[model samples]
Target chain A: MPNTFAVPDYFVSPTLLTRARTIAQEHASLAKRLATDYDVSAARRLGELQSTSTAVREYDEAHSALEELQSLLTSTDQELRELAEEDIQPTRDRIEQASAALKSSLVPVHPFAHLPCLVEIRPGAGGDEAAIFAGDLVRMYKGYCARVGLRSTQLKYDTADEPTHVQEAVLEVDSPGSYGMLRCEAGVHRVQRVPATESKGRTHTSAASVLVLPSIPTEGGGDMGEASFDDPKSDYYVDPKEVKLEVMRAGGAGGQHVNKTESAVRLTHLPTNIVVAMQDSRSQLANREKAWQLLRSRIAQLRREEREEEIAKLRRGAGAGKVGRENKVRTYNWGQQRVSDHRSGLDVRNLDNVMEGGEALERIMQSVRTWMAEQEVLSLVAEEENSQAQKK
Target chain B: MPRLAPSLLRQARAIDVLLPPLLPACRDLRSAENELRWLKDHAIKTGRQCGLAHSDASLKRLVARRARGEPIQYILGTEYFGDLELKCQPGVLIPRQETAASVTHLAQQLSKKRKGRPSDLHILDLCSGSGCIPLLFHHEFYAQPGNEHCKLHMVGADISVQALELARRNQKSQIAAQSKRVTAQTTSLAAMRFLHADVLLSEAANAIHAPIGVVEALQQLTNTRPTPAYEVLISNPPYISSQAFRTTTARSVRNFEPKLALVPDNPSSAPSALDGDVFYPRLLALADQLRTEIILFEVADIDQAQRVATLLARQSTWRTVEIWRDEPGATSDEADHVLLDGGESVPVRGAGNGRSVFAYRGAAAAWLQ
Candidate 1:
């Protein structure tokens, strides 16, 4: 609803672009300072300054070339304009590539950017239909994952009391660095449709809340990537003393009552009051491990948001509709047979196709990615502003 | 993705035996080319037996056998399951892709269970034709870096002495041809004990046609006076209907595979499913006696799964009975759903088309009587 899917040139914050010149200037001064001092502190400062300087130079070179080529497009001379037109595509590509490299160097890395992701979806409001729509959301994401070549493992899926419909589900995207791409998918999604079970053909509004968290690397088991879960400095690390563990019989659907023993493990983080229940595993130990993982990820995400609060303005009003957590980010309306992503304001008319994660879904995801990158640029811009203010 | 080479295509054309189509079925052109490399290796190794070393003849013979409905694994001598290559021979059933999938699913479940547990574990493989299940588990358990010290004492019980012998050889060969993935671990292969006992009879030795002195045989293999309590019981027990085997089963399987491995030998008084699901009830009873935590069985299909679920429900010994799909990574939601108390329906959560049933004892919640 914010409709912030600006053009590529304007998407990056102006402050970051201006800060490139400043970073270049600082690097020059730092190099001189290092040469004069030749101390450990100056040498370390130089080490950090070196990459920043290179990235700034790279961004400036591409940005300037793009600006020059763009100006030539309006040249009076016909031959020059034709030359500009011919070179425009290549020059734009170079700028985009350089900016990507520059952005990676400039922006502070999200602590969990390289970790895998877990997506938990639950019905928020709208009763039985909401649960049914939640199931649909699960299918949509699963389809999207398939199209994107991201492997999703169903960690837990609970059907509604009706037995035929799904109520809540958790799917783990196992691909490394999936968290960076999927993190912004958290928040609320709204749907408006006539309930199939309704006899009166009344349109009912429903919502599903999606929470995306970074999955901890399974200690010593599971997939290849080995990530630390015990290091205090690591974002994913959780203090065992702060957690309260409980094991009970795994409940809900088919997994229930199958184990004559108590196999389900639930972890409550005393500090955060965050509760995570895991019973999919038959062994209590397995359940405990999974529950601990879920708890760690939740706490880590909360920690990230606490840090993100300082630059929360970078994400200001990205979602327009004030329906649920951080505004309803997307709406799927069956009456209009359309899916509208609020941040990008991308309206794809084919609801079925969007739900299937077809071309329509791809278009929305790509635009959202662009918007997220712009937000990162804005955050970098804010960081530069803070440092500049301090210096002044 | 390489296209089939023109020369290879020409060579396939020249060869009279029907190996061309079979090669591509294994993989794309690259797979066919790889098989060609294996054929060449076989050819260069021996020239005496049936002129195997005379390159072209060896390829022709290999193809001819496959073309005549012999399983490619049998002819190839090894089937790769997980990271291990199980030696396949006649009489013993070849390790199927479905079987490999079942092993993978079971191992993942067990790996989670093995967290901070005892290093030494015992497993029983009923109707373990090729000893693939235990051997595959042996490899999977030691696959991780820190679990190198984990030891698995595996028992493979089958009535056929031929199958038992092949199973033993598979155990030796799999241990010898250690997978590079598991070389990070120094754990030896599971200590194997091949039991020549029929599960149907009261006495283990009496179950078999020939008296192999069951207790003596088991002792000789295990070197343990009394068998330890098995933690896991796994089987790919035969569940095919007589009619399906006679009519619906694949021509190659019907023609070549041992009938003893595919069908219940004497089925007139068979206990369940009206066809031959006698093994399901027997295995459940056996599981009750063993008090095994996990029981995994490969079924014929969803229909057989339904029949087995009914048996588990009737037996009322276990807490949860789940139908698992055999295809890797496929969601349990896509698999068949079984109705529980209060008319709740839930899919057996795991990968594949739900061709297997994974039942473990949960807090003894009573099933519908």
Candidate 2:
């Protein structure tokens, strides 16, 4: 069979190899330090570098094997030359696999990659039809999580008057590292189908936006040092002063005089004007805690995106333009029964399988993840080229 | 109360037949919906556990009980105080968010002062309703990594036997919930005790059988502290005056919560102060007797907080005194100060109505500052 997994005619870039070597060296020193005296940040960094160091080792071994095989190709014996030639192709293929792994491992790991995520789905366009599609997407995600054996909870599901219509829904994928696996599903998703609300039998275009955020634990999980709110340098660290907390309590005496059960809590990050309101839990304390968590996740995501935008501007790949939240990442065409990922350019004919979050959905997500890693490598190459040009 | 709109009631009824019954107490559609959801969840869980009749029937009954102005905490039998969920009964006052906020703020300050150094700490809560204050304090303080090493002794005293019983039940449930997170070796539940005592009556005024004073009762209950000098004294005592209870208290509170927890008995007997203000003098005297370093007393509003602060100032015992608003940590633009009858004034921290009077003396002066 043809090796479809192989990147066609791929070669390892010198800049990427140099980056990988430095990472391997850092990993070695971190491992030594970790053995003698343990530190949380040091351990976490070491974990991130594990894959990069492995890939570097594999690449080095494959390159040496290929060179050894090439040297034997020059043997005076005809039998030896033929054997060396036959083995060279396989060794070269091994080298190509290592190169691809090395390239992907160099892409910076997302800071929130280890955390469980909150997937928020909101209708973007096409009014009522968009709302219906948003509902479908919510179910699709829930189905995906169930199929994958990931624990999921619907944090907030606001439904409209019509059946199968949703205003907004937030699904908390409660499995750790789900953020890393599901983050590529973010951005606008466009859908084309004949809506139930439609009078005419014509296909119409609608869109819904998906936002995935890290669900940071509230207390005692302080081991997530950088993600914990106590650290001022952490993106999750929100100044208590900047937040405005509103409780829906009766105006009269609050303590013993009132027995009101209104437990809704709203927190607004005043600087960014990001508001998170939670009334899902009957306990006021629980609602307040959930609100604070949602607020922190959103603020952290915003801050990280802002930093990414600055880096992307510097990297500036011409063909690799940034596909942000506004850009359509995937399309679901009901008429053609096709689900297409815009970035990966992968299309699946089984619409039912995609909507059911079956193998087709997994295939699309895997393609997008690969496409994202390639984009990261392209940006790294672009950065190297920019710096070299400046040196000239 | 004004009548709920027909349209709103219909809307609630449309949501769930049980939801409309909650609208009168909840006063709005959103809260009614929330209460109904919680009630339904409570019904199913408890019914299934106890093997009771249908949860749907129980849900209808719970909705009816809520409509008649019963506190949801009492109906559900649990209320969240800080991170600890305390069991609630009708007689014991439900733990308030304001009280939790003050307790949390104090715990944060205490932990910050400890700075990983372990030391013996004792807390006394007067008129402890569901034992919420001390249990919450223990939860917050021991949440820090090094605090489990520190010897924590807590005493919660209430006049009513029912309150004390609920307090002990709350402690058991808290320990059960806490044991899942922490190892048994470091559990401070042993050091915590609940006693039945009336703060208003002096030891001389009461019979030998009935414990009247906090310090005397605590010494009788525990062997570790024969004469305990607590580090902190906290209380959310019955502070609402008889007139306020009649004029200002909510219908749910007036109709359902224990009257012993809401209004102090016999205002005419306490000649010097308002009926609600009667508890402060007794608590202050107890604080002095116990040699309590820090005291936090919950009040009705700014006026009451000022009155309590003035009472504390008259003794010149505390090094520093501050009144904290509903949210003690929140920043505000307005100048926060409560003007006393004297030319001097005390600083008020945070925003909203002044909810607590916080004072620290001796070693605690340095900790709070």
Candidate 3:
């Protein structure tokens, strides 16, 4: 039987109700604009304009604005949903008395918010047994992905020899709630078990580390525009002496043409000693443009790194050194069949069920959210104390 | 002015006459001439001067072997890299030109970095194969001033015993040829040891056959040194992707090398069971633990290089990853900005050639941070 759960009455606090009304009105306005203003005829004309020189800029600007508006609507909807949940949680006991719901639906917010997490799990010092445990940890993740209905994509993977053991594997899990849920899964995971390959069933210790990154929206993705590059209004010329351009015939996997022509252009920035080559393009101009694109991205990446460093420095001053430090996070001991998240201080004994994912993940996710809420409260209290001290 | 000696001209003529039959199919006149000159010089130095006709026959056989897809070095039984004559064996991956470039880079860096001109530097070469890397380093470092006091305590590790034996032979021949050079050293024996070890093995016992003391010494040198045990960590491990193994033409695959070295053994293993790129991660982990100051890893192409850069960027420890090309005169920070998929120009750094990842640990972090 599917258990039914109701949203509690206290969840509908006055502040939350006002916020929800404002969000609904904004969403309605966006819906109206999307329907009436964004007509099929205009879209077709816009597509045509996109291909033409005269109207292309206008078309692009319009498209960007539309995208921004749509994102705004989506964000507003998300915020309203979170507010609803906050209001509902206060009346949790009343909701439980109301109905038994099999599928518990809380607003599924993207879990990796606010905190950048580091996951580290390595095969412990125990030889093949350690390696084997590393392999199991990787599988446990895959199983966890399935349970959470998350998709696991290989960011990188390294395979061992015959009698297969995973030397190392890094996987990126895509889910709304992954970063928050997997944050609990960082640090040294120790495994104690008899190797399947061993004749004498002797227990050995192994370890693996997992790092979770809350996939931040890129610079221009949302309201986080601080890191986005402001395009220089004026054209800047690279000193002729500073730039070295070499034309070469591109090689590898590409066809005979790859070896035939000097289509590939290698640009060397002498000042920075950075070299970018683009041979994938058919023409030299295209290749140069491609190379420039790569260069810009790198510069942008550097800027992003600088911003992160500054924020980290500030955080250190604020006495939250342990929050973002890439040291210890979590541990999984296969011998004990236990997984522990050091940050939240939560331990789950059912390794198999957790690895398999789903309901097991829900419990872990709840624990993480509670931890996050407590941290927020602590931060608020600290701020209040600082203000009070200033007045005194 | 020194004129061309008649005897030298005569030998050159003899080598020239023998070269045609040796390289009948080869069209590059310059390459053929270079080969002949090299071989003739070797023959004359060894005092095993051959008649013009006999030299022709030998050259022809060597050329024929090359034409039949055998590496020229393997056919000749030797190849000179740096100052060492390394043995080239069948089934072993030949030392590549890019590898030579990286070795030279490391040697130059090490010479500049090390203090007091120490008589010997402890160096470990994993996946040593024919021990070309250690041999080159030994030859170069020994030739430097104050290096006479410098003993090169070198260890070459490889899982293949056959390869290890071949490497040992190569080292022996090199040491014998340079015995006079070796005698200039004042320190204890310039120890050169080979241990059969699989880097992939989590346990040392699964791989190494050395005595406990030796093992402990090596481990200590690797871990506890005020400076890293090895001034430089260099490896050209099997980096061929599984996709390449599966999809490469038969001419390149079946005709050239062993599948064991090229592809991961079990293709059908679960995603969790297999690491797609095995050597790179292991090297990274080793670097992390051993804290080796410098690492030079050979990769296939730009895509792999980019993947490595991304992998390194994700790590807290690794920083300042710059790719190098096979070509000379390549700079590390040569930025050529081009637009990306979103039409944004990104700065390109390093040798924009066949992909090679050259990164330093603390330096890059310090620079960027």
Each model's lDDT: 0.67, 0.83, 0.52
Please compute DockQ, using alpha carbons, for every candidate against the native two-chain complex: 0.02, 0.37, 0.01
CAPRI rating of model 3? incorrect
Compare the candidates by lDDT and give the number of the best one. 2
User: Each prediction's interface RMSD?
Assistant: 18.6, 2.5, 19.0
Q: Which stretch of 10 consecutive residues in model 2 chain A shows the poorest summed lDDT?
A: A1-10
User: Could you give candidate 3's per-residue lDDT for residues A159-265 as a string of tens digits?
Assistant: 34322455655555655445666755554655656678779877665555554544433232443223222324211223446667775632443210011123356
Task: Give the lowest summed-lDDT range of ten residues in model 3 chain A.
Answer: A98-107
Q: Comparing 2 and 3 by TM-score, which wins?
A: 2
Candidate 3 chain B least-lDDT 10 residues: B22-31
Compared with the true structure, what per-residue lDDT tens digits does model 1 show for residues B313-348? Answer: 776656667777655334435645767543545456
- In model 2, chain B matches the true chain B with a TM-score of 0.92
